[model samples]
Target chain A: MTGDTELRDRQAMMKAALQAYVDRANAGDADGLVALFAPDAVIEDPIGSPLKTGADIPAWFADTVAFGTRITPVAPLRGSHANEALLVFDVEFTPPGGEPMRIRSADACTFNDAGLITRLRAFWGPGDIEPA
Target chain B: MTGDTELRDRQAMMKAALQAYVDRANAGDADGLVALFAPDAVIEDPIGSPLKTGADIPAWFADTVAFGTRITPVAPLRGSHANEALLVFDVEFTPPGGEPMRIRSADACTFNDAGLITRLRAFWGPGDIEPA
Candidate 1:
């Protein structure tokens, strides 16, 4: 394929992979979310938060996405030249007996050829949270 | 449709829109690139550069993507929750009778519901350029 076509195709694949990630998270399927990663994947959901890899990733998802947390894309998606991408969205976390808190943030991710995410670095902080 | 499917669909559309943008730029299709933006889209390429809007956007594309400049994504694309996203990539500019320079940068963009970009803020500086 031509260079443009190849690049466009890669972007599409990357987009699909990212969407699948959100899909899994939105479904509250912690296992599904973990399946999107490579065996050696690294995850830093909040940049400075504890780094997670391999078997440690699922727990992160379970802890984060549990209790009916939902994430929705608030803006358009942009692709970089490599298979790495940054995603910004609103994450709504509702504790069982607490109010919902909305946090706006983004994550940078890298994917392997198999389309599994190999690294994810989330960028956000308490300041990004929407006021109640 | 379920929320997951709807979200996936939106993500797909966003990816296609972003891909069209890079394709237009790589082909030196200045008009095509401009057409990707909404009528009143805002463009702040490099963030520090003069902001471009309305009729001024075409000139920005001409000046920036002109010559034999090529952009390649070094990372995957991430979509925000608001139809906005950030793209990180390397831009290679070969000035006529000048050496080629590769600069790494990222652009944060917002799109209208129609899939046309409404705002674009590029994040980069001279420091992001790679040494030959």
Candidate 2:
């Protein structure tokens, strides 16, 4: 295949991988969610310590789920190169007997040659739920 | 010009623009430094308020010079598109009769269609200089 074709294929795979993570997370499938990352993937969430490996991802996910946070990953902003992409969107969830909170975040994802996510850096603001 | 030639020209222009900023800052030429940005440009420094418009940039530059800060913009990490670039470098300076401080920062710059810088977002760690 040509270089352009290869790049296109890699981009498609990356998009699928990112969507799968969001799907499994929202579905509360911890194992499936963690399986999307590489063995030594790094995830830096906005409000938590960075997770450096696959082993640590499960605990992080568990904590997020425990917090009653649900993430709905939106469409990503494609970079010029297919190896990198940026996803910006909002998340909504409710705490125990409390009103729903909405958070907007931007995640920059870099994919390895194997099409697995190597780095996922998330950026968000810390604030309480504002009335809509 | 062809697409590749156009991209190359833009990249060279951007490199020159960034280097000019560093040179002028190091030489304390505040006027020349601010001339690089567009009239309505926006600059978000690391430890200060954002400066909007060309008029606000001089005060910001003057304050930085007064703080004994010297910025040396190193090479940029080029994005896929020539219009966007990421610059990661370190700055070193000493306060009045105090030890020198070195700070590492990353700036993402976006250029307008005319190739003038429209947005400059800076990121850095707040700390003292460590031993080399």
Candidate 3:
């Protein structure tokens, strides 16, 4: 494929991967979510939080799935000219020993050539959280 | 102030800078837009596009203003725990000799301690654009 065509294909693939992330998260499929990430992937949920990589990734998603997190996209998935995608969504989840809450989140994800997410940085400050 | 308090303040500053970006772009004030960026700021509009920095930054905004671009944010400005913020907006601009066009865009910006934008990467693939 031509360079332009290759980039276009990559954009499509990145968007598709983002959709799969949402679907898998909503399904409470921690393994499925983990599968979408590269082995060397790094995740910083809420940006300021600690990074999750290697085995920490699976553990993080396990906790995520246990929280019963559900993602509802507020805007259409956005793709870049490069190998990155953005997802703007509202997430509802039950916090440990607390009532369910909602947070407005925008996740910026970068993917490798293999289409696996290599880095994920979620943007959602404390002000974004509210009672669901 | 405490570290947490400092970070919170930074987040607020970042969000305000993003609002300024939208307002300045809509007002066609290239100088104002340029001022919000750090001296060493780098911008990649549409991600895959060429990077604009130093003198190129001003020229890029000059063309942006020349295009008569107006930004209408579709979502609230989202802040991160770190020095980053996201703005999802729809842009209406007139290309040279072409009719007005609309493009759905999501910009991720990283700010410096002084609240100036240090880096900006916009997400908007070909499919995200359409006739205005």
C-alpha lDDT values of all predictions: 0.69, 0.60, 0.91
Chain B TM-scores across candidates? 0.86, 0.77, 0.96
Ranking by DockQ: 3, 1, 2
The DockQ-based CAPRI class assigned to model 2 is incorrect
Model 3 clash pairs?
A: none
Model 1 per-residue lDDT tens digits across residues A1-132? 125566556667767877987888888888888888899999876554577887688777887676677878754454555566556577888766778787766766777878788998765543356633
Q: Give the alpha carbon lDDT tens digit for every residue of B77-131 in model 1.
A: 6554335555556788876567878776666677777888888876553335564
Candidate number achieving the greatest TM-score relative to the actual structure: 3
TM-score of every candidate relative to the true structure? 0.51, 0.46, 0.95
**Model 2 agreement with the true structure over A1-132: per-residue lDDT tens digits:** 126567557657766777776777678777786677777888866423344566677787675666566776443333323365445446676655667777655555777888777887664423312432
Write the residue-wise lDDT of candidate 3 on B4-107 in tens digits.
78877888899889999999999999999999999999999989888989999999999899999999999888888888899999999998999999999999
Number of backbone-clashing residue pairs for each candidate, in the order shown: 26, 0, 0
Worst 10 residues of 1 chain A by lDDT: A123-132
The native-contact fraction of candidate 1 is 0.01
The runs of at least 3 residues in candidate 1 whose Cα sits more than 4 Å from the true structure, single-residue gaps closed, are A95-98, B1-132
DockQ of each: 0.05, 0.03, 0.62
DockQ, prediction 2: 0.03
Best by DockQ: 3
lDDT of 1: 0.69
